[model samples]
Target: MNETKEMRLAAINNLIKFISERGRRFFYRERNRMTGEPQTAYLKLKNNRIYFVDAYTSKEVYAYSGYPHDGFSHGGTLWALVCDFSIFVRTGKSSNGKHGYGGLYSGDWGHGDEIQEEIINYAKEIGYLE
Candidate 1:
């Protein structure tokens, strides 16, 4: 879905704040059998939508919609990072194809350096990250 520069940046800023307040407490990663290193950021939900942001990716990532559900259910938690910042669940099952886009390759999309840049730019534009 398309979003205005303002809205995108606002969301980004909000995410940053949320992360700072929660600190690393909101993160979860799995160990890589081969490298023996932990995977990147873990997807988790707080409010109603799934917030997508990776500390590893220098590039800015977008906020993808999560499972379609309300905040009342799921203990007011409805976020899940299925794969990077691309595939996420906000309220219900947020399949890539289900949202109208076909980026359903079952892969992580928050590996790009632009993820950070995008987030910074949007945050600044919306006065959130500043």
Candidate 2:
């Protein structure tokens, strides 16, 4: 079924709201600098933004400097992801269907079938599917 762009965007945003409201956290794979042992932490989100102080430790593994990817956040790259999902629902095609994300995506930034899967699955889980 096809849906409007605005509708899809709203659904996506709602899913994010659901997560943030629950105070849910995610972890990134990181190795302890001092002990050389890998560990995970509950990455914190404050006021709709991720803060370093929110994490259990100051050190974060697999940190990104500028933008976030097509993952579960709403930032630089997520804007594109939202647009792509909207287009897919409306047009039934996402950037030629070659790549999961829309337009010219690169692995360096936001590009992966995993993100697409996350979006679809989460949307369905949250009753965002249309």
User: TM-scores of all models?
Assistant: 0.25, 0.28
Per-residue lDDT over 93-122 for candidate 2, one digit per residue giving the tens place of the 0 to 100 score: 443222244332334333256664554456
Q: Please identify model 1 stretches exceeding 4 Å from their true place.
A: 1-39, 55-62, 65-88, 98-101, 105-130
- What's the TM for model 2? 0.28
| lDDT accuracy of residue 85 in candidate 2 | 38
Task: Please state the error at residue 79 of candidate 1 in Å.
Answer: 15
**Clash total of candidate 1:** 21
Best by lDDT: 2
Query: Pairing residues by index, what is the TM-score of model 1?
Result: 0.25
